[model samples]
Target: MEPNATTNENLNLYEKAENYTKTSLELLKLKTVCSVADVVSTLTSKIAVGVVVAFFTLFLNIGISLWVGKELGEYYYGFFIMALFYLIVAIVIHKTHHKLIKTPIGNTIISSILKEKQN
Candidate 1:
């Protein structure tokens, strides 16, 4: 009888451990899903806003280029000036991209993934 009781206790312990492991795995899966959803949603919204801003910038630049050309008495000259401006801007961005873009984006992604649930 004592041996049978010992065997039953061992079985119960095994079952409890199994259940604990399953629960932990489920919790991990849930947290992963939550994090991915949060990141994707945030990115989607930001991209939408970025698209709108990009369009605005495009039209604004076109208008400015036209006005500058009118003032300078040549459309192509205005475009050349704008192109030169952009070339300088591009060079500046290329020089500082790692500091201005890469590090901030990497940190944002890491922080988003590791951020705890607020509720």
Candidate 2:
């Protein structure tokens, strides 16, 4: 091959390698974004789950209130009972947040973030 042709071929290979490197970097960045997004999605879904559980708990309280009202013949006492139930549920959820973090997926995400920070 002529000297000029050989130089052109080398330049072409260099350009291709640079392009590949750029693409790889872009993919890594995308993966990092996705990882962060996964954490956020998990957090948002957990919030939605907590809301659903709370609503169901409230429904149970309402049902209990209705039942008790029928038995005691006083609708107002049921409100007090429901309040107590709400208080108990709130306390239980507050106490178990750390416990929930021990689940497999949660632990993985937490460990990943911690590792990232250490690096």
Candidate 3:
């Protein structure tokens, strides 16, 4: 083979490599965008659900408190009782933060991201 032909072949190979690199970069960018969108969507939905549940819980607590107040003939005692209940619950959740909330949430996000990658 002539030296000039060999040089031409090298240049052609370089061009193909550059093109491949650009294509790979674009694919990576697209994947990153998709991953972000998926995670955001999951979090948004979770937040919406959480808000709805929180509202339901709040109203339920208020209703129960009012009923208890009527029974006890004291309007404020029921509120205190509800507050105490919530305090205990908060403490328990704080103590078991990792097992009850953190780990599961982490695993869920990771799994969802991985699942998206697989697709």
Candidate 4:
């Protein structure tokens, strides 16, 4: 082939490769967004569960404290004990919430996003 013609063909091939790379990057971005959305959905579902459980816990705590006060004949100590118990329960729930956020569903979504990025 002529020198100019060969150079033009090389330029064309370079342009095509650049275009493919751009397209692939865009697709990866889209996949990452979709995976993030999936993770958010999972979090939302778990949050709903947490809310219900929290309300139940609240009622149970109140009822138990009231019962203990009546039985033990000491309202002040009953209240203090209830407060301590709730503090411990809150700490446990906080840790559990963190763990749940890193669960398989969340990890899978994150992994998919990373895989898309790598590709």
Sort all candidates by TM-score, best to worst. 1, 3, 4, 2
The alpha-carbon deviation from the true structure for residue 11 of candidate 2, after best TM-score superposition, in angstroms, is: 1.7
Q: Candidate 1: where is the Cα deviation over 4 Å?
A: 117-119
Worst 10 residues of 1 by lDDT: 110-119
Best by lDDT: 1
TM-score leader:
1
Candidate 2 lDDT for residue 81: 80
Clashing pairs in 1: none
lDDT of 4 by residue, 1-119 (tens): 69999999999999999999999999878886877886788679988999999999889988888888888998766777899987998888788975764585567766756765575
TM-score of each: 0.95, 0.55, 0.94, 0.67
Model 2, position 77, has a per-residue lDDT of 82
Worst 10 residues of 2 by lDDT: 110-119
**lDDT of model 4, residue 94:** 88
lDDT of 3 at 62: 94
- Let me know the TM-score candidate 3 reaches against the reference structure: 0.94
lDDT of 1 by residue, 1-119 (tens): 99999999999999999999999999989999999999999999999999999999999989889999999999887888999999999999999999999999999988999885544
Which of 2 and 3 is the better model by TM-score?
Answer: 3
